[model samples]
Target: MKRILAVLLVMALLMSCVSLAVAEEKKSLTVWIPQYQFSKAEDAISDQDFWDGVFDKFEEENNCEVKVEIVGWGVYGDTFFTSLLNEDGPDVVYVTDNYDLVKRDLLLGLDPYLTDEQKDNYILWSTAPENAAGEKVIVPMDDGVAIGYVNTDILAEAGYDELPLEWDAFIEAGKIIQEKTGKRAFLQNWGATSGTSALMLAFWPYYFQAGGKMLDENGQISINNEAGLKTVEFLKKLFDEGIFDEDIVTESESVDKFANGEVAYIVADLNKGNTTFTPAGVNWQYVFSLKGDAGFGARTATDSFAVNKKTLERGNDELAVKALVYITSGEVMDAFHSQIFYLPPYTKDASFVKDEALYALTSAHSDAIYVVEEFEAKKSFEDTLLANIQDMFQGNLTPQEVLDETMEYYNTQLKEE
Candidate 1:
């Protein structure tokens, strides 16, 4: 009996040592991402479940733990910056723009991890990956284009069979829409609540249509010119004629209103229409950005994944990059965008497209789509521009004054930067 007890005790000690060795062998990585179009309903798969589904296989294969945190958009920027300043958290992060982070040298370049096949197969922005000097900091995941959603029923009622494609005719159509249908002609959200999306969807397209470039030959912001004035004056015309309501400056429900058949037209990102308008049974067709004196133009936005430089300090830089590559692989991005929005996958291998016809239509307008240029003072420039536009809408500033003031502020901010 004493011999048997000694043998059992020796076996138990060996097992305990084995467990400790395995624990030491495992590695961990943390990923921070903003909640992008995720459903929060009780019946919906939880964000954790979705991430686990994507990462579990990787974890099992590599003996690594991947921790994903889905953050709210409101607090994401502040939280990310704060955590980064502390030299902790987030091995990888979702990036819409990495200008500021790259400027601060807080992001890692992705060129080493990218394969030749990926470089050849992925549809990338002209300046992406190398948007900051020659550093390849971002790996493209998904992309969306801004489009005008024209309520077909409203168009017909307003004595038009289809929305016009030219700026002058489009404004004339808006006037006719109000005169005949007794409803608002167009709705655009200009409030701060709508944030940069409003600028991307409604304002930038028109400005671009008028040939307004954000910067001049010397790389300074210069919007107080013919293109800027034309765009603002056109908007003021829509306001003065009552085609669009003054309340647009504060209205956050333009899309909802248009979805419910209360407005003739609304400009929104192409990915948004199927969610609100389709469910409401609003008969609508997309209208590409209208032509102006310069030409037709609209902004397409891209979302990507980037590595945080903090991973180097944690001694898991390669592991973190491997996780990022896995997360943004063509197959993963294809499945992810399919579940959330109708955005096109940047990778060629991702085959799921929700609507082929709509995809074809949007693709036809690809020539006119330009990505927003990243600069040091992008946030402040956009904010001041939006504020000045609001003031112009409220009759506090003329269209010329709007351009003059916004241009001055943008230049001053750039100089200080």
Candidate 2:
């Protein structure tokens, strides 16, 4: 009986050893990337192939295993924040939402991992910010502008051999196309009903071109002045003349509509056009200029990757940073923007004949807004501005009244926050 009991104990110990050995063979670093990224390919298998082609090399060179988790944009922020409390969270996170995570002290500071030479790789000196603790947490991977797109087929249908360069000509062309083809002629890339996301990029450029300031040296809302009023009036004009759709809300996108030939012209940056219009094999070209009372210009936008602070304590922070540096550096970055359909900010000029005109207008941004990015306060400002603008459109308020409300709401929120 003693011998029988001893044998059973030895058997149990052997089983546990085998399980431990199997787990040891597959330890891996986890990375979370947005689902839509690298999804330009037709199907899931092809998309996976594209990712594997790039990541497999890194895995081999580093001799470390990795697990790539494709996170969806819809629930990415919610899931990431919840999962971050776990010690086994992803080593790197890509952020498209607000930089709230950084301000909240969630992400790892990348300053320690980066070198001056690597910083010089970008054309602009945007790497460093005064808020080194807060703003300098991201490694910028994608940057672009919002500009115009023209369908050659639509232009020809409108009886034009060349695209228009000024706002008046552009609107006139839109009218001709709508009258001739019985289709909507123009659409802004953004939905008008949403918050400041689209308006900031689509309209702010024009405001700046007209020498309108969005904020003052004291950080006061300055768009209520001449520039702000003119912009509001211009938007109203577009609505009144039916040149722009009044019903465009946060859910609408002009690119998808443009691809179906419902729209003759649109406002989309090179990257957005590249991914949507180019892939659909639409007869399109970028006719970027649409000058207002001021001049032609566009606003630049960016998306970036941030490291996880807990990964540093895990002793794999170096590997995580290396992965980030490689992903955003040289060949990867060039290929990313090229395939994704936007020019790198460092590209000397809009010399690429294929998309020259678009870049020519957007590449040299005239009025870049360096507004204070207090996340909660900015959200409050945009919400109030959106409501006031809606009231102005509904005849419940005047542009001046809207502007006054905007300033009051923003200042109050700024102080409260």
Candidate 3:
């Protein structure tokens, strides 16, 4: 009887050990990314194929399983913030221009995991505001600048050889195109609420060209000054010339107008390099923003990788950080750009990009890829300014009134915050 009891006790112990081993072997992780390139199955899984392959490689190397979830870029902020509030959430997340505002409570600080040298490998601007506190919150994956897309065919038809080099020249060309073609010269995405970031992208070059600065080094609002006013007046002139599409408030309508060849020029980012002109089968060329009075200036935005703090605190941070480093590596970035057709974040030689039109724009406008660090703490103010500008576009307010109302609203928000 004693022997039988001993055998049974040993068997029970053995089974318990086996169960624990199985649980340990079943390691898994989740990653949340934007839907931009990953929305379609071909682009997400096959065309680039590297993202999935890299995840699988990480799984093999770490002996774990990775699950990727695609979220829309528009809703990523809300979804990521809400998920962070929950105990069970993704181990890693992706962020873009909105990271600075979203990092307050939602993101994990990676200072504890990364060495100084490891951190130094990344572009400082790509990680900033989030990493301003010496805590690394994001890793940059890709970088690109806003650029001008001109349908040269339309310009040639209007009796122009190339895009105008200055704002006045640009306007004159547009007017000529309108007169010759009886179609809108420029089609911009605009609406009644606030100028879309796209419009802001278009307007920024002009502001810089007009010798205006968005803010000073001390973070004071400088855009309300005379130079900034001139910039607003320039946009108003464009609107009044009847060169821009009538439905400036609706982007879809603007896009339709441009796509149908009813518009001569459009403003776009690098991602649109392939889709906007190529898909339309139009003979188009990209130009750097026409030189502004203060020299040419451009605004660049980035999307980065960030880890979840709660997950790191739970002792799973090393894997997350490793995954981030892998994704942000030059090889991965180059591969991603090759597939998605975006500018690389890392400052590397892009001689390999064989597309002449893209290469020309990137080369000439390279200086305009303004890193975020170049600007101070006025993103909120800029947002308000953009909103008020949209109100001006809608004709609900004059340019001067828009500036005054925006300043008032911004000051009030500053006090409340």
Candidate 4:
């Protein structure tokens, strides 16, 4: 009886040791948040500190480590995919457009974790990931509604109190700003595509306002039509008239021009522009739409919290979902909104009235899907558009030549995909 009792005690001790060993293994969830308006790492204290402090509570609650990395927009896309291919944690990525990851089947659909009741508490600027096939793979952290900021102080020089909401009047006003101030009237990102997205930061909104789209019902190339021709012609007119800064051929340069008050008109999302300018004491009136002859439209995108499939595969999906929910919840979102105006969260009712005002202006503009889930088709479509825009701007190709060449490549390549 004594020997049997001793053996039972030994088995219990062994089982307890195995349990402690398993618990000792630590798993970390890494979140990739794009750097805000500031370019230098030293200037990113608000973002880094806030996140670092917030994650401590999450780590405590989940019993897992959390890593928050601030990544630059320039190389984020390439790095995200490489990480995914390696089954890395860029596990919970917060980005401007994560549709590619969803379409590529790399992102785990979040619907199973985030319930409908959770979605009801917030107003979403975009419908849940447009083509997710019921996965709701992305949780929108903020609205990416594009708004045009008019430097009223600069426009006052031209005797306009506000930017005209009518498209033609706005153009006339921009021309006046150009003629009187000798500063460019308006600027768009003509120099570079936003990471992997071709339509993003490009003049595609103007193209969309003129009724342009990348693909048709059958995924056929469709951007070489009449509306597209009109868009290119209008672009050429802007070029000929010096509406665009010929010297500012890159996005950073163009944004710099706006930041330094060298230009009067700037078009970008609210979060991207106001966060910098408002702090600098620059005052501007935001307009959501500049109606064109084809009627007015606006563009919107979501910067969402997207999941990594590997997180779920490793059975840590609960930790990721809960952490994201906690971050987007009331007090946390209020803190986040206080620092940066990325609109509001989808799981909370927010009083970012000032931001909503700018977003409201853009509400009149229809939202279009520039990026689809099919990785190659989406990238190819946008890349062709960007390349042709560059060629047109350089005076190497006419508008028709640009569209024709772009159409050829888009059709040929998309078919192969």
Worst 10 residues of 2 by lDDT: 345-354
Over 1-417, each residue of candidate 4 has an lDDT whose tens digit, in order, gives 999999999999999999898777766788878765353436444677778888998888777898998888776767776777785557777755464576677877777776777766545623556334566777666656565777777899888887775555766787888888877788776666442343554455666677766556874557788778887787777777667646435645555667778778776766755566776667777766555555665555656777778887877787877877777776777767766445544455555444666545554343532322233455656777777777787888999998898778766765454
Give one digit per residue, the lDDT tens place, for model 2 in 1-417.
999999999999998999878667543577777754544456434434455567788888886677778777666666887667678888877765444565467777776677777766654437322133543666655455566778888788888888775666766777788889888887764445546565655566666555675557874456678877777776666656777654643425777888877888776655656667877878887754466666765555545677777887888888988887777666665554554434544422213233555555544543442222334455556667776766665567777787787887666655453
Give the distance in Å from residue 191's predicted Cα in candidate 4 to where it truly belongs.
Answer: 2.6
- lDDT score for residue 188 of model 4: 71
- The alpha-carbon deviation from the true structure for residue 214 of candidate 2, after best TM-score superposition, in angstroms, is 4.4
Off by over 4 Å in 1: 1-4, 37-43, 129-133, 413-415
The 10-residue segment with the lowest total lDDT in model 4: 366-375
Evaluation by TM-score, superior candidate among 3 and 4: 3
Tens-place lDDT digits, model 3, residues 1-417: 999999999999999999889778766677887755633435344432556776877888887777888776665656776776788878887765444434355576777777776777775433455544666577665566667777777888888898886777778888988899787788766552333354456566667667776556764555677767777887888888766544665554555556677778876675564666567777777776666566676666656777877776666777877877777766666666666455644634223353666666666666565654423234556667666766787787787877788777767764243
* CA lDDT, every model vs. true structure: 0.77, 0.64, 0.67, 0.67
Best by TM-score: 1
TM-score per candidate, chains pooled? 0.93, 0.76, 0.83, 0.81
lDDT of 1 by residue, 114-165 (tens): 6777666667734574635576777766577787888999889977888886
Provide C-alpha RMSD values for all models, in order: 2.2, 5.5, 4.0, 4.6
Off by over 4 Å in 2: 1-28, 37-49, 81-88, 124-135, 157-163, 168-181, 189-197, 212-215, 218-222, 245-251, 272-274, 278-281, 334-375, 413-415
Model 2 RMSD vs true structure? 5.5
Using TM-score as the yardstick, the better of models 1 and 3 is 1
- lDDT of candidate 4? 0.67
What TM-score quantifies how close candidate 3 is to the native fold?
0.83
Full candidate order by lDDT, most accurate first: 1, 4, 3, 2
